[model samples]
Target: MPTPASLVSPRLPAQAAIAVPTSRIHALRTGARAAGLIAAGLGMLGLLGGWLHWPPLATLGAGSVPMEPNSALMSLLCGVSLIFALRSPQSARRSTCPLAFAALAVAALTLSQWASGVDFGLDGLLVQGGASPPPLTALAFIALSLGLIAMCKRGRIHTQLSEAAALAAASAALVGLLGLIFSVQSLGGETRSPPSAVALPSMLAVLALAAGMMSARPDGPVVSVLASSQPGAQFGRRLLGWLLCAPLLAALLQAGVQRGWVGGSSALALGVFIALAALAAAIVSSARRLNAAALHCELELGQLRQAAVVFRSSNEAIVITDAQANILTANRAYEDITGYPVDELAGQNPRLMKSGRHDTEFYRMIWRELHERGAWRGEVWNRRKNGEVYAVWQSISAIRDDDGSVTNYVSLLADITSIKEAEARLQHLAHHDPLTDMPNRLLFANTLERSLAHAKRHQHRLALLLVDLDRFKRVNDTLGHPAGDRLLQVMAERLHSKLRSGDTLARLGGDEFSVLVADAGSREEIAALAGKLVANAAQPVWLEGRSVDTSISVGIAIFPDDA
Candidate 1:
């Protein structure tokens, strides 16, 4: 049977599998870039408002605290850093470090000035009358800088660290945003006097920075899990959206009551009811979908178990490998044919059984076919544990994931050593004489035709000599056919030894033999070779306790000279 191109698990229905769309990934990256741009634009507006005396641009509205000049500058630095962090790792690190460090330094210095009760010149450095950013805003900027730094580094731990920092910054910024929305008077009370609260624009900028950081590093564990197309992520996203929007909905109702559009108690009661109803509805919808998905997964798992059984019990040697071609598992038949146990073969590269018969280019073609067409089938010679070379008809298939990335390779190998041996034996018998173990008449004629063509093309000479054992009929009549057979074999070996390595010696039939001398050089060389053949044939050989002598008569025909 032909090996399956994709294994059972990969063949599952699209709905039953986790399909991470390439378009979605691209959207996430684009969103990250947009978020960075938005943060930078907001920062630039704040800087302009501070300089141009525009309250709306800096504070986002009348009676709101303005985003400090230092805060706006930090935001600008972080925005640039976040954008740079989205690039290739090497370039990201090189470009993002300076911006991230500058942001970190400014935020640290501002926080240090606040804690020590000192006026840091950094606050009013950009604007003459500007106050330092609120303590909460400075802390958020610090977290944002650290996150950008972590995002530029490689490894899962660094990714998780960056994600954690982004979440921390987002949470801090969200608190500031909530304070502004609810008009909370006590949110930033850090001194005898009311401390300057986190500005509306500053909070928004930090939120944008946090969002951009998370979106830029989609491979991070937290982002990957949240953005995944699995059932759990989808369900979690639904509940999360509801939770965020439900509070805002409740807050709007509270604002209406404060404005006297509704009774306070009635608004509170209605808000509770609405929140609970939405929660219950979301739960019901998610539960039904998840239950259906669970059933589908169960069916798929059962099918995979059956496939596993077939894989283990199959007569053909099967090997499963990771994308890197490291062996993951192999069937019993594989162990039997390769003479290696599963324990030893596991985690090993498939090149362990390579035979020297094929060159590097041969394996390159197989890999090329597998990548282009996802499958390849051909004969391969591999060495066994005992150093015996064996041939196998091998079929390899690449197994890909829902993302169209190759995840594993499945190789099915069937031993063809015995078949190859049988073919070789049949081929040899068809082209050779049985008695003297030399080329037969048919093979000799074909060889002569090919040699003549080669000689004609290259302007070379060739000699075709027909040789006969003199008085062979007398030996057959007196000493029996067995002695005559032995005499023919002996004469054939002697005649072959007298010619060059590129010569063909064939036994036509009975005492008749032919020799093809390719590239025969000159007439003198041909005559010398014939004399040597005659001298060697005259030598005696013992057969059945008696010495038998044989002589050969040669008739030469040169190509283009005598034809």
Candidate 2:
């Protein structure tokens, strides 16, 4: 089990957060550019009309008022502000704010002139003689300026506020368009006082500028659904043109009747007929879309049900986590293998099971590979809930959403502890004696080679001893092989006891042994150890109700002196 300290601090570093910009955002950028360009072109034409004394460019017809130069200038500023914001969204405060503020100041001064009946000299700044833009036009410019300013900041709330301001500007622009279409000077119904008419070009410029501002942040509350490719969004898009054109068409029809261009009785009948036809068409389209959506939902539900069954019944341990790596769910096999119940595992980080065998860089590499390649598989050691450290072969995959952002991570782990243990056992048996539980000749030879290198490097002497039991074949022939095996075991233990702690003793074969003294002293010291081993074997023993006599011969070699 992970200690409390390890459990609290996870090993994997926090993943670097990223923003995946989708194609929808790119489309929005194109739309914004188009709207900005259209607005700027119209504003330029209106100014040219005033500067050159050409009324047709500023007005829709002979009776319409010309667009004031100040109104044209404001439109130009708003359009340029939008383009700058889009071009440098990261630095909009520095690049786009000044133009937005200038437009705001102009509109504010225009409003002040109207309210206080005082001339601020802001109207007709470019032309000597022309009516000032209408109060509605000034209001629209103010709303567009605020929207552009709001675009300079970033956040959900700021984006929503910007979209809302764009909507307000669009509403004001639409009102001006309607007023000009009806050829009315009144800002409201006929009962109210007549106000200066908003010029046609000014109204068009404001409308396009408002649209550009709305496009600045398509992910905002009002624009997200409009820009989405969902079924509902498709339906909404289909209905948008009809919703916009129907009311204007009706108003024009009513105006025609009032002007005696069409008879009133016939106009009313035609209006009712058109309204019914539109309603029927909308109903039919909505029914077809709803039916298709219902079928799609059913198909998805069936797929989800099958997936759930597979997830639950899988034999390998499976765990799923959210993008932040907090555990969201785990299968039964996962709980069983980890020794953690489902309830205890939920909301916990997977690092709680870390065995502390791997370093921090190991986990960093895992996360880096996972992020870059989306999948990783490797063997790792983890501690179970009961404090047993075990090996597992694990595979991990990252799941993403439509925008290519990581949503979740799913991992599968298979226990390989028994396999690892078997490998270790096999390795140990390859180099050790089976009967005596000691290093055999193979291990002794390897050890001697390593010791020789070390002694050569340090210029130290090493002593090698070859030991033999004299006349051991006679006992095996008379007392049988079992009696010979008993004597060899006894003699091996006696030789081992006579050696120093740092000395190595090994069984070469039947009744043959080798000893290595890695830290050899003087020649006298080496002879003394050899004499002790000889004396140790000279003692007699009784075996099988008969007295057996045993003796040993010892031969020695010194490194650098012999060989």
Error of 2 at 62 (Å): 9.6
Clashing pairs in 2: 1-387
Q: Which candidate achieves the best lDDT against the true structure?
A: 1
What's the lDDT for candidate 2?
Answer: 0.80
Whole-model lDDT values for every prediction = 0.83, 0.80
Query: Candidate 2's residue-wise lDDT over 17-54, tens digit each?
Result: 22215777787788898888877777787788888888
Error of 2 at 390 (Å): 1.8
**Per-residue alpha-carbon lDDT of candidate 1 for residues 260-318, written as tens digits (9 for 90 to 100):** 99997898788889878877887888888899999998997787777777877899999
After best superposition, candidate 2 residue 50: deviation in angstroms?
3.0
Q: What is the C-alpha RMSD of each candidate to the true structure, in Å?
A: 4.0, 6.7
Per-residue error (Å), model 2, residue 303: 2.4
